[model samples]
Target: MNGKKFVESHFHKYLTEHLNAEIALNTIQNFDIAMNWIRSTFFYVRAVRNPSSKYELQPRMDKDLIDRKIEEMCLRQIKELQKNGLVILNGMNLQTTVYGKLMSKYYLSFETMKLFRQIKGSETYLETINTIVKCKEFSDFVIRANEKGILNQLNGSPIRFPIRGRIRSNEDKISCLIQAVFGNLTLPTPALIQESIKIIRIGDRLSKCLLEYLRLRQSNDSKFRCYKALLNALTIVKCFHAKLWENSEFASKQIRKIGAVHSSLLVNAGKTTIKSISETDARTIESILNLSAPFGNELLLNIMITYPTYLLDISLKSENVIQVHLKQLNEEYIYIGSHTVLIVGDSLNNLLLYEENV
Candidate 1:
């Protein structure tokens, strides 16, 4: 079938299933309810899809009937929002609630918003990642015929989280791919690597959305679960950027000039990843990577110097500012963010840490 017919048939089947289930049409009480409402769009879809003269649609609706249908659809959706606590219908005007605002800020779909609303902000880090994969954004990722083998291969290799049973649905693919990214598992092909990276970038954004949601949840209840979820969200956010788990010895592989082999070798020899290279002598790391005498020092210096030397100001008569302010000890840089950093300018400048705040 053509694209239009295919979409029509898809919706027809969807509506039929909803009808067979005897699902209510008034309010979307949860994610499943919201999804059903989303899928049950046959009536309006047909009305809109049949404008072409070639198509013969159902009996034409008069102006009054069309307006009534429009009103009914709008009211049904509004009721769904009310049921989900996303909006408040006071008299005539419908006002958005905090949940609604949060959903709007993230540009989340109604279905996704419902799912987010249900989360209590107490899930484990792995659970949080799994929850994020359920977003509507990942629904379109088609798992190839042979991709499941690769996913299972990644799971068996060294992923932070592994799945059991058959890998079903795109959500599973996303979750597996994310774990593969964190573990730095060698994807079979570059295409697969690129695909995983794209998913990672999108997943990173959704993870941020969940982080904010958890933070809000914590503020309201102040429960241990809420605080834990917030903390997990924070860690998950950083992991997404670093592309490695916090405990992964090979997390340093994300740095420039560092690879899985380099990290593995260094980690095995009892050296540092990226964080505490300062504690280890440069010569030790150098010898492990098998570089000549001074190159190890140079490698160490290059990597350490770029670890968040803030661009306070870059000065010039051309009105450029300059002053490298070392902010509080954190992986994030004031200018070039992320643990993996490259100081573009001042290749000649040396980085020194001050014991006291400057």
Candidate 2:
């Protein structure tokens, strides 16, 4: 099947099985109640885990994006547990067990399966999930795994089918198992090799997925290509946010400030993807922009990609003053407009583009 169908089929099957199992296990008299509870739980966990969209830069808020992010987040956590030879199922904490529940339907360790009950009424469920999905710990794990050929080793094992592997050493069986999931490690093309190194340095699951997706492509579909382009745009914006956040407290604290920086960066990525759009999609976007948007169509897409759910309002309440409302963080405002407006710039020379009257 096609890429979209592939993702949708797997996701639908997974969701159906999960919801039915929840109803049966809970003995909930009402199927509607069980379905509502299960969906709310998914949304709650998602909101916390993907908080980057709420601050700094806009995260991809699409269901596909959320699903991919959380899956990888949990997967990286599993890889970390495996690499350390920690009994993947041995953890009993509220947060760690979310990983267990998330993968219980799959072939994870038995101990991990046993921990799913810990999440049933846990008070820290949301906080635990937040920490799991947002934590940077997995990035380091991935880097070490890359260096050790641990992923390659696990994929080649006879115990694991379809997926392949190779190993630098048999020092850790769990590491080998982790490699099994990726199948055989083909030599990455020179382009992919460069992409891998860049993504590794960015050190986030999203970037890791982007690199992997690029390496695993065979589709010629335009929709798939656009979807892939959107991923690349997000990777670029996220990496930009990450690097700036690492080096400066201001960038971390000031959401709108960093946003303007990434907005400028996304304009370039947006320009390329704009050409790939169908005329219908293009017109729909144009119609939406015709209603009081400050930026042109391309820049608006940059903003949408950069900050998916944010509200940006332009207020010219005063002749000498302009107000840009970046609604997610109410305390933040960015200044940019017109010719020769005075600019306050960041250390990286990310111009906080605020322009008033000439």
**Leading candidate by TM-score:** 1
Q: Write one digit per residue (lDDT tens) for candidate 1, span 182-238.
A: 876778877778888888888788888887775565445543245445556667887
Tell me the tens digit of each residue's lDDT in model 2 across 1-358: 6555311112221343343334334432343343335446544354445535432224656655554555444444434444423223324221222233333333323333233212221123222222222323223333344444434533444422322334444222223322221222332345334543443343344333332332222122222222323233233334333433222322312232224334233333342222222122534444433423333455434433443233567777797566666544322433343112232323332323434232
The per-model lDDT (C-alpha) reads 0.62, 0.34
Which regions of candidate 1 are displaced past 4 Å? Answer: 1-59, 221-225, 283-287, 290-299, 302-358
Backbone clashes under 3 angstroms, per model: 8, 20
**Which segments of candidate 2 are over 4 A away from where they belong?**
1-99, 103-297, 301-358
What's the C-alpha lDDT at position 74 in model 1? 50
Error of 2 at 134 (Å): 18
